[model samples]
Target: MNSAEVLSSDLDLVRRSLLVQKSEILNKHMEFKNLQHSSAKATDEADAVVQDLQDNLNIQLHERDQFSLLLIDKALSKFADGTYGLCECCADVIDVRRLKARPLATLCIACMEDQEAPGKHLFQ
Candidate 1:
């Protein structure tokens, strides 16, 4: 497909991803707050563990929301400049499969592979 078509699709996906992230962040914030409030009332180790899990989830959700915001901003800027498919790392056309999977991606598969290789534990 053409660059214009790819950019259009990427923008649409970025918009959807931002919306979903907003909702998820809000929900996670609420859950974390509730857990914090009730944690003092926790009577057993199980409740403490659950509260700890909720705290961890809140941190993860916040990080993901931040990442989503950054990706959205980058994608919008790229769309405006008509260079969305050009890899930020190498200025080459990103593979279609990679772009389809990560619509807001600013780097090509090769660059992404290098970035990911050094951070395998960060993924999950």
Candidate 2:
């Protein structure tokens, strides 16, 4: 109905979405761990090379999932602190649209752009 109500609803949705993502990542991580532990023995050099490649790919995927989990956890913590959807850099309320699009986003668009800008020194 009102802006506050809408924002609350949006935040609730974001929280649910983040939880779902966290669960999915955790499930996938567990499955990958099981697969790694049960990997088939290499029969020959070619098989060994393929197994190595597959192992390397799995590690990379696991690392990526771990990073995603971290971001999701941070976002969920923000909700607990009553600061979800607020820009970390400006302390301003991030646009609800942006939050919907990227539930793990910490910085608002302007701040993100500035951070990504080339030749922009942070220490200067």
Candidate 3:
């Protein structure tokens, strides 16, 4: 395929992925909000602990979704700058499979592994 076609295909993939994730996040948020409202009406002391745990889990999920949204936004911005699919750390083209799996990935696998290595920051 031509470069323009390839770019259009990749952009469509990333956009679709982001839209799906955002839809999921919004649905979860609404569910959690409903749960919170329902729980507020509960008077049973035994259920308090369970509710607390559920609330904590919901908060964690929301935080994770927010971070994912940020990554998606950054990826979209990179697309606008004609830099999408290029590793942020090494300027190498990230593998198409990896990009398909993680649409917002900024680093190639090797660079990601290096960043994730134990004591990597200590050496730097």
Candidate 4:
């Protein structure tokens, strides 16, 4: 097919993947919520401590999942706006490998590295 068809197909694939991931993350967050509530019934001192640690871990995991879900949502919006495969910072096409690795990515490797670079002065 043509380039437009190929891009449409790729965006469809990305959309499907992100929807599946979003569902899975929501399910896990629900499970974590249930676990957190159930842990309040821990009786033994050791059990309570263990439960606390588990709760903390669950909270951290849920927060990361939430952030991922938000990114996926933003990516979906980009797709709607016909800018799915383009880098947000430089407006160039993002690498396919990077998109495959992180479908929700909005930046290309160079832009991402620049954003992540440490010790850069604000003025320069």
Candidate 5:
């Protein structure tokens, strides 16, 4: 088909991928919550230390999953507003390959590189 059709198809794919990721994250989060609630109390000092470390790791994982969900939601919102695949900084269309690789990416490669450059200032 034409360019518009191709872009639309790509966006649809990205949207589907994002939704799948969101669902997976939600399911994992639920499982984590259940596991946390059902965890047995430590009976010894060594067990307590191990449990504390495990709890810390679980919290970090939960936070990471939360952040991923937020990014996925933001990307889905962009799709709703007809702005998916557009760079947030330069307003240029982001490469479909990049989007396919990182569905939550909001910047084109050039803008991303610029932002990551040393001594670069980011406003807001």
Candidate 6:
């Protein structure tokens, strides 16, 4: 049942993502404050630095948003499929602790280890 409706419990994952978003917003506010102070003296190099920081922050926030969305979507799908907290690969049951820590994870630790470990044959 590969459905896309997340379980109610997955809202905890969304909450965690929201916390990350809040931190990012705080960082952006700090950066804006610094930019405001720097623009007072407004040298070309300083202007460039502020612009670069803004660009970097934008990219970072975009990536974070994308990651959050991916996690949420995974949770939603699992809810629909009645496979929430189960490993997508190998069909093994995922530990509750693992899910709490990493709701976005699709693979069980065993599967993850298999992927990360280079087999001897592959090294040859």
Candidates 1 and 4 compared: the better one by lDDT is 4
Least lDDT summed over 10 consecutive residues: which range in candidate 6? 1-10
Candidate 1 lDDT over 1-124, as tens digits, reads 9987976776567656655765776777677677677676767999779877877887787788767767767776776777877898899987756766777777888888878797675875
Candidate 3 lDDT, tens digit per residue, 19-121? Answer: 7887887788788888889779656877887778887988998899888778877887787888989998999988877888888788999999999899989
Q: Tell me the spans in candidate 5 whose CA falls farther than 4 Å from its real position.
A: 120-124
- Residue lDDT tens for model 2, 1-124: 9999998998899899999999999999899988877777667999889899999999999999989999999999889989888899998889999999999888999999889998788656
Q: What is residue 35's positional error in candidate 3, in angstroms?
A: 1.7
| Local distance difference test values of all predictions, in order | 0.73, 0.90, 0.83, 0.83, 0.90, 0.67
Number of backbone collisions per candidate: 0, 0, 0, 0, 0, 1
TM-score of 6: 0.55
Worst 10-residue lDDT window for candidate 5 reads: 115-124
Model 3 scores a TM of 0.79
Model 6, backbone clash pairs (residues 3+ apart or across chains), number:
1
Error of 4 at 120 (Å): 7.1
Which of the predicted structures, 2 or 4, would earn the higher TM-score when compared with the native?
2
In candidate 3, which residue pairs clash? none
Q: Taking the tens digit of each residue's C-alpha lDDT, what string does model 6 give over 1-124?
A: 2322453345456446645755675676577667657656646997778877876886677677667666666666676677876777788877656766776677889888878787844874
**lDDT digits (tens) for residues 1-124 of candidate 4:** 9986986677688778988988998888888778777667899999989888887888788789889989988887887888888988999999766786789888999998988888665747
Runs off by more than 4 Å, candidate 4 = 116-124
Q: Give the worst 10-residue stretch by lDDT in candidate 1.
A: 10-19
Which residue pairs of candidate 4 clash? none
- The runs of at least 3 residues in candidate 2 whose Cα sits more than 4 Å from the true structure, single-residue gaps closed, are 120-124
Q: Per-residue error at 94 for model 6, in Å? A: 1.0
